[model samples]
Target: MAGGRIVVGVDGSAPSLKALKWAAGQAALTGDSLETVISWEYPASWATLMPGVPPEFDPERLAKQILKQAVDQALTPEVAATVTRTVVGGNAAQALIDQAKGASLLVVGDRGYSGFKAAVLGSVSSHVAQHAPCPVVVVRGETGDDEDA
Candidate 1:
């Protein structure tokens, strides 16, 4: 196994699924523990303001659900067994950066939900690549080598 922890950010996107697979393979090869993180924000509500609204809503449960579903759909049973999941609030880029502080490598998808229609990389992925403490890998969609030529 590898000597350091491998952390991957997953957001249920196709690129994220690819990144998860890649991270799993790396973890398996290096014998490093894998930490799968999924960050979520509560949906904004336009309903009448309640007098007793909580300071911060717990998106952890929702993040967990999404992460679990993504993992179940993307990985084989054996590969999925090796991952550990975490959920946090705030921006996805910041969350991944925080997680990267203790990790050997951070993996993310090239594009996710936070992208303009013609964007090459998602905002979070681009930000994390520029600022993460650990090495970052951005998984891109699979395409023939000649496609970009």
Candidate 2:
């Protein structure tokens, strides 16, 4: 967390991309720096079955790649240029909460890449909304009735 920062959680989902666009628009207007965070976790179950960490398996690198891809997809070149990328190995909610402690706001999608698509709020977004130190914005897509699904 840092002063004058706005944090947004991204997972490459459509909602997340929409959220990123929304957040970027806000950042441009408010002059606050945007930090795009994408969290990841390697399953603990893999530890028991694997002899050693694979040379080809780099979770952090993969996380950054995902973050980069999401940013490229969601934002215009001007918007994406001003953003700072953060990749962490842990729970997305907790990471977002911590990142928001010194932020002006926390923005997330209505849902993410996970099961329970019908749920109004995905687990990560729900947790961040309830616990973030700053005010939270959950961006949902669709500008009008016909566009909503």
Candidate 3:
């Protein structure tokens, strides 16, 4: 057994789905527990940009739903049975790192659902890759536009 478990970050992105799938397979093969996590935070900038944002529309709830869907989509029923889902409020990278303390592996997508067109690695992936306590895998999305960007 590798230390504790395998931690994976999901943000409802295609790359995230791939990461989750990869993690699930690894966990099953290695007999390590799987922790599927999604992190959410109401950015301070968003408050100023959209002051009328409804409080009833909880971002955490949405993040939880997305996590659940991503896990369901990525892992088969048998594989998913071994997963433990989690939702936390904080920076995505930090949430993943915190939960990955003694994990054997930390997996994340190359980029999330961000609309930014400039960078190859998103902030979360870059942060987690640089800071994760364990080995990290950054799953590449199949989008052909990555090189052109």
Candidate 4:
């Protein structure tokens, strides 16, 4: 899909940064526009567990900052400038799935959780892979490497 949009989920994790890098490279090769997305939600029990949230504690703002930093770190200035950043409020997997509605590709990171933890909590990449409207790429491994696979 030439000149299509590539949607990628970034959460400031090492793996997500790697995914962002991979998505940017793919966009470069495909002549597609890159759109980086991040999502945030308040804990289910936040109102009961911590009744008084700080007035200045804004999860959405924090998410936006993380998204911006991830894109800046993962791509060059010229490329970063061309990228579209999106911040959404809701479940991460669902957010990506919704954002990827007509996208050429959806990319996310495999956080590499193992065994019991993975089975217990599941994962965003795993969920999106099964549910995204478009093809998905789950980037896995160390984050800082520049090698291409």
Q: How close to the true structure is residue 144 of candidate 4, measured as C-alpha lDDT?
A: 70
- Model 2, residue 18: distance off in Å is 0.5
lDDT order of candidates, top first: 4, 3, 2, 1
- Please tell me which predicted candidate would have the highest TM-score against the true structure: 3
Q: Which ten residues in a row have the lowest lDDT in candidate 2?
A: 113-122
lDDT scores for all predictions?
0.82, 0.84, 0.84, 0.86
In model 2, the Cα lDDT at residue 59 comes to: 76
Ranked by TM-score, the better of candidates 2 and 3 is 3
Better of 3 and 4 by TM-score: 3
lDDT of 4 by residue, 20-94 (tens): 999999999999999999999887776776678887899899989988888888899999999999999998889
Give RMSD (Å) of candidate 1 vs. truth.
4.9
Backbone clash total for model 3 is: 0
Model 1 residue 14 CA deviation (Å) reads 0.6
lDDT of 3 by residue, 1-149 (tens): 75469999999988789888888878768888899999998776887866888878898889988988887887888877778999999878899999989889999988887534376457888899899999999877777767522
Residue 38 in model 1: shift from native, Å? 0.6
Q: TM-score, each model?
A: 0.79, 0.83, 0.86, 0.86
| Clash pairs (backbone) in predicted model 2 | none
Output the lDDT of residue 140, model 3: 77
**Model 2, span 62-145: residue lDDT tens:** 889889999998888888887999988887889889878889989999788753356645788888878889899998766578
User: Which segments of model 3 are wrong by more than 4 Å?
Assistant: 115-121, 143-149
